[model samples]
Target: MKFNNKIVIVTGGARGIGASIVQHFINAGAIVHILDREFPDSFDVGGNDSVFRASGDVTNSDDVKSFIKGVVTKSGRIDSLVNNAGIIRDNMIWKMDESDFDAVIDVNLKGPWLMCKEIAPIMREQNNGRIVNIASRSWLGSAGQSNYSSSKGGIVSLTRVLALELGKNNITVNAVAPGLIDTPMTRSLPPEVFKKLENTIPTKKAGHPEDIAHAVAFLASDESKFINGQVIHVDGGKSIGANLH
Candidate 1:
């Protein structure tokens, strides 16, 4: 996947899975732009002239719009967008706080909506673009994750709708639903919990961020022109069904 000179925007790319996507695109020769609230101390966005970093809140429409505008002004055009910005506030429905629900929905769902709303026009005008939304396997449903699941489910629907709305303009919109990828957030889980979660996966192992990045790169590439409005699961068969064994 040679993305030489391609301008790619990745949200929440300061660390973890988002950071991996940024690195992958940069390796593929895409001019990668990152938008995140804060970057990690170990974040090594160095050694790559194609990498650009910015601080912004995806949940803020003004911030999102301004960031996109700045990227366009500097890069002239955006070839692909990775809506990888998301938050998780897990709680059982009965115990969930309204603030937690609002926060998750705002960041996970509304953020992507705003991004697509702003970038859609630019892609349409240019008559070419690719959108890879980072949804989750949890969208299928998960206990104590009502809010998070709902938001990702909305992203799945949004991806499909955007594909239909933007297809005529030669744009492809798809989603990568990752399952149990090892990231900072997942690593924070209790060892017992993490082990149990790994056991549940058919592969009996967690995925790496690079696994998801590879899928995003494919969907973002021109080769996937015919594949639109689809959700590709990068979950090592976890989405197939529960182990039940």
Candidate 2:
């Protein structure tokens, strides 16, 4: 777990699962660069010299380019890129506005795609790198989440294609499909709805952000070099049978 001297960038690192991933890498001794629209107002990212924060929207290609450039300027190299920045605009397919679908896709899928487009060349030149995309089990099928589901599905497909395209350059690309993680996003869910969702899980427990972070950390590690083009589920078995209820 020691990432001594490693340089990593995590998009959406200001909150929730992304924050957990940043903290994990920072604790492991990596020079962590975080890209977020803004740091969460409540928490503090102080006291860590190895942690660098960049404020910008991931959906903007220019912002992503500048952030990656800044990371290279400060860290001297890019060892890993966690494409964790995303958003959800949920609604039934028939009820969903085109804008909702486009927004979700722009942030969730296009944002990561753009990050990869910018950072992959750096990795290729160095001949070593890891890219982990944060996706969701909702991609399987979720009512009232047409926009969100489509975006995540796109992530899975993008991960596989990137793996094939990047492996030749000694870069590994993978993804984590998380489900029911306890985070600011889920905290906004209505109590009754959240409870019912939990009740359906075999684990009967919502996942922590760290649950997903651990998977991303592993994928980013050298130990997982051969495990590319795969989407590992961190859903407490939810993908298997957590919804049988």
lDDT of each: 0.94, 0.90
**TM-score of each prediction:** 0.98, 0.97
Per-residue lDDT of 1-245 in model 2, one digit per residue for the tens? 88998999999999999999988998888888999998867756555788988899999999999989899888889999999988877777888899998999999999999999999899999999999999998988889998899899999999999999999988999999998988888878888989888887779999999999899999999899889899998887888853565
Worst lDDT 10-window in candidate 2: 39-48
* Per-residue lDDT value at 227 in model 2: 95
TM-score for model 2? 0.97
- Model 1: per-residue lDDT, tens digit, 91-154? 7999999999999999999999999999999999999999999999999999989999999999
lDDT leader: 1
> Global lDDT for candidate 1?
0.94
- lDDT measured at residue 106 in model 1 versus the true structure, 0 to 100: 94
lDDT score, residue 136, model 1? 98
Per-prediction tally of clashes: 0, 0
